[model samples]
Target: MACRSCRRQLALLMRQTTTATEFQNVAILRQFVATRPPRLDQRRNFGSTPRQLGVRDIIAQVFKNSAEPYRVVQATEHIYKACAREASYTISAKDRTAGTIPKTAEGEDLGEGTTMWHNEFKLPPTFSTWSQVTMLHMYLIFARLRDLDREVARSWQRQLIDHYFFDAEEKMDLVHGISSRGLRHRYLKDLFIQWRGIIAAYDEGVVKGDSVLASAVWRNVYKARDDVDVRALAAIVSWMRLCLKMLDQIPDESLYFQTESVFKWPAKNEFMLVDKPVRELEDALQPTVTSAPAKAPVKVAAKATA
Candidate 1:
């Protein structure tokens, strides 16, 4: 099918063509273009007449700017399925080599030369990386919301909390035989790294931290900077949806302790220093505490004897 831009342009072309024959010619040209896949030749050339540039050209520009990540979570699922299949293996047999099999004069060997195949799983790094990137994007969006509305911010935070630890634990439980050490030590390790990166990004200006976190943060969040071509909002939405889907696969009570332990909400202010943004938000959402002092200060009397 012609791209949205091409279709829009064709409509305008029909309007511009005054004569019936010209309109027919334009229709034929549009049909011919539609049948062919997009090519450099089909693109508007510098030499093209003013008629070539119209609503289509304007739309192409608008569409280009309107680009956003779409169905990323769904795309991630497809990738996961591909990865799962790629890593799966089954037993099979190999062909017998020459002179390997014990055969009769007719060249039929009865279990003399034998070959076998063993099961194997071929895991791909792409799947893991994609999963991590999607999670990071999800966290970033939540981080952005943390500044906007308190309820929305809280929901996102809860989602991040519920998702990273609780949801993942459940999912990991499905493969019953999978070892805790492997799941905790390896998978959670990577997730923890992503989690820390999210915190670092969100608290870059406000928190007291080393530059190492800053330098490494962006790299961990985006798998390949070049591969991600979407608005930040769209990317996060895709990831959030993916996280929801992942929630279903999670088994009950997998391992939330390790997940929750990775991130700490900023400490609440007791003395009300220059309230930082997070602290301010926290204090507002939090209930106020009214504590009475144990003892009032006693007034000292001036010395009577000089």
Candidate 2:
């Protein structure tokens, strides 16, 4: 057997070794944790250091004070381009022809004289339709920007409108075959006037109620036609309200960095006006009732016999 002193030294050495091993394990664990990727919900600071900043980012920051404004401009231009493309997309001839007439099982005419304007019921792919839709999206952004600094908001608004009109002018030249610069300028001027009018009319309607807003949409989009479909009008108004509500919920930073397809118009089936449940409001207004105390039973005195 080893002497008592020797056994004590061994025990001490073992304890030291175990302690050192534990420390090493802890250090390894700390390094692993430090290098681990961030969670999906967590936001990482892309501009935390100079090394993290890209050339454009650095330029934007140096010149514009913050890269956010430049990003907003880029995002707005992207949105306008997307809207322009959407507006210019023409309905396929086959689909248009199929929609105009109802046919039997053998492709025979069913003698139904009524023509189906299926494209009109939803968002149509035309310049006028695109303009209205693009304006609506721009309005939502403007609405959000109302809370921003006046100068900053004005700058963003100017850039956004400028990009839109520029794209519009290009579309007019290439797609619509308006090659004359003078004519394109005149058309752009008219469109700007219309845009201003739309903003004023729509703002008034939003302040009043949905009916008023629907009327404005009808007048602007349908050109105040007597035979305008009420369902289509209602759908457009509902879609506008939904889009505004969604934009309102998104943070400004997130909105500025949102993807190109983020502002896509809702599909026919998804077009809905989501409102808070009536029961929820009623519950909020009413107070909760607790159980009442049991009333003592009163014994009726027996009637005196006469």
Candidate 3:
């Protein structure tokens, strides 16, 4: 700025010169005020294109985005959604005048659906039964989430149960038609206690053995009914083991995102892999020798009569 101002002043002075001698002398003199050069960027150049992210960097970013505090809830929401869908089953409203539930063709009282669980297993069509069944499924998801990093697993498990209560309370209002807020709140507290017991019982059952797990299922899902089907208890234990194996096969990255794909209900009368013997499990590992190709089916028809 100073140099520009001086240059302007010099020009004016030369223009106003009365004598040619002064203007000639000033023009002849070398420039005293030097012009400053333009500034240049000195930042280091990495490359023309931005550097690509590594596997670790991408993973860190993924974890950071999906597993953070409030964000974790949103990221793992699909897990709860899947659990809720699998666990959700409705009991049809009873016929007020008939004073009995709708019956199946065999004179058995039909449940909303899942004839095996409701009718065959003798589970009642009520809110409590629904809750017990829902909790059983939720525990399966909770167990798999336990395999993740401590904090990450904790977040997922917390949300899993939290979502359960939220849905339960909603059902209490909409489905069960219990409009009293205070009554609903009381029921929710009790349900929360039950959920805690379920987690402990299930974790112990899974760790010890199938018999122990069956007992847990007997108590939890069967509600300790005297006539509870032993086969039903066995079937639950088998399904749980199968679900855990499926969960284990899934990559950690897919734990929360695609976990719904693993929540499959057992087919009626379909032998689960858990119950099948390992060697004969789904005929996966058959005998290889083949009895020496059945001795080439020797032609001994004529020798038989001799």
Best by TM-score: 3
lDDT of 2 by residue, 1-306 (tens): 996446533543443344333454455546544654546666667656333444345344344433444455567667656544533444334544555534444442233111112264543345666677677667767776776777657656766787787677766765555789999999899999999998898998889998999899888866677888776777667766766776667776665655334456552433333323445688899999899999999999999999
Per-residue lDDT for 150 in model 3? 81
lDDT of each: 0.38, 0.62, 0.64
Off by over 4 Å in 3: 1-43, 46-75, 91-111, 114-116, 265-306
Candidate numbers, best lDDT first, in rank order: 3, 2, 1
Clashes of 3: 0
Candidate 3 structure quality by residue, lDDT tens digits, 146-203: 7888856875676566566766877777665678999999989999899889989998
lDDT of 1 by residue, 99-218 (tens): 343333333222311111011111122324334443544453444444544643453344344334433443344322234756555766676676766666545622443333333333
**TM-score, structure 1 vs. true:** 0.26
**Candidate 3 vs. true structure, TM-score:** 0.61
Model 2 reaches what TM-score against the true structure? 0.56
